[model samples]
Target: MTYSLLNLAFLVPAAVLALVATLRVPHRRRFLRGLGLTLLVVLVLTAIFDNVMIGIGLVAYEREHLSGVFIGIAPIEDFSYAVFAAVVLPSLWSLLRPSRRRPRAHA
Candidate 1:
């Protein structure tokens, strides 16, 4: 299989878990859209900065095995960092917010 496709093995599962974790919190839809859009912006900014740094040889990918898709000189793995950031930030944000409603009385 191609290197790009090989990455799906990790990215897809991590994304699925992220989605599931995000959805498990109540009021998810109310916040998820805004959170996702915010993450998109952060992702783009970080990707550009990271790729440029890699291109300039400031830091390097230690892993020899990498998906060869390059944004300039950075590997696709760089973008995956954004995905994790998107998932994790939102999950933590939800965890921090206090619940708005108390549980209903048990019958």
Candidate 2:
């Protein structure tokens, strides 16, 4: 399979987890706002760093397996990892972590 297909396979589950978190977690507006900002920052950083890494020969992809879409030298398929960082992991953290507002346990 192509890199884009691999990215899609990973991204679909992460997107579902993020969606579930949006529904079940508290402070929906804040979560969305933070998600947007985080996505923006992470994507930009990923673009810059990925381009640099590729330029310097620190990273490489086979042309046959790539989607042929790029931001500079970085493959577009590379950005799904940034989405996972900006969205899925945070959603999982929020979903899995105990709430700060939980009532103190009775003695």
Candidate 3:
């Protein structure tokens, strides 16, 4: 399978997991804002580091596996890992943590 299709295999599930976590997570607006910021930083770092690696020949793509899309010689497929990390980590935390809602008191 091509790299893009391979990435879709994992990304789709992670996206679903993130959506479910969002529902469980309180403070919806805050969570979304944090998620956005995390994604921005992770993607930016990936772009910079990936380009450096590809440029220095420390990394290489088969070209046939790639979709021919690139950011500074780093294949677009390389960025999927960054996206996955950014989405999945916070989501898993939200899912695993106990709910803050307290039990109701009986009068």
Candidate 4:
């Protein structure tokens, strides 16, 4: 298939949201840096998973009408899923942690 301009449009918003979320972590900037490092790890894992699936005949590509990018057996669009999951996972994990609000004393 010809590259979908519509599909390609998604990357801008995804990257913007990742940037915004990473910048909003209260005073824990170091945590955000570590989160970015973690995201790299997650991206690698997802790419490997997708590669294995494609290798085992679990997924197939329509090569004749395909978009022009590939990573080994995986398509370029496929890797974006990995990037998206990596960026989102840390933001979601931070939300699950308890907040640091101090207890108020009785008046």
Leading candidate by TM-score: 3
Candidate 1 — which pairs collide? none
Model 2 TM-score, 2 decimals: 0.90
Candidate 4 lDDT over 36-89, as tens digits, reads 787778767867888899999998766764677877777776766656666666
Over the stretch 55-107, how does candidate 2's per-residue lDDT look in tens digits? Answer: 99998898999989889989998898898778887898889998788788999
By lDDT, is 2 or 4 better? 2
Which ten contiguous residues of candidate 2 have the minimum total lDDT? 84-93
- Tell me how far candidate 1 lies from the true structure as C-alpha RMSD in angstroms: 4.3
- Tens digits of per-residue lDDT, candidate 1, 9-43, equal 76687667667757777767766786788788977
Q: How would you order the candidates by TM-score, starting with the best?
A: 3, 2, 4, 1
lDDT, candidate 3, 1-107, per-residue tens: 79999999999999998999889787888888999999999999999999999899998888888999888889999999999999999999888988888999999
lDDT values for all models: 0.72, 0.89, 0.93, 0.70
All-Cα superposition RMSD per candidate: 4.3, 2.1, 1.5, 3.0
Q: Arrange candidates by lDDT, highest first: which order?
A: 3, 2, 1, 4
Off by over 4 Å in 4: 1-10, 64-66, 95-98
For model 1, the run of ten residues with the poorest summed lDDT: 1-10
Clashing pairs in 4: 1-65, 1-66
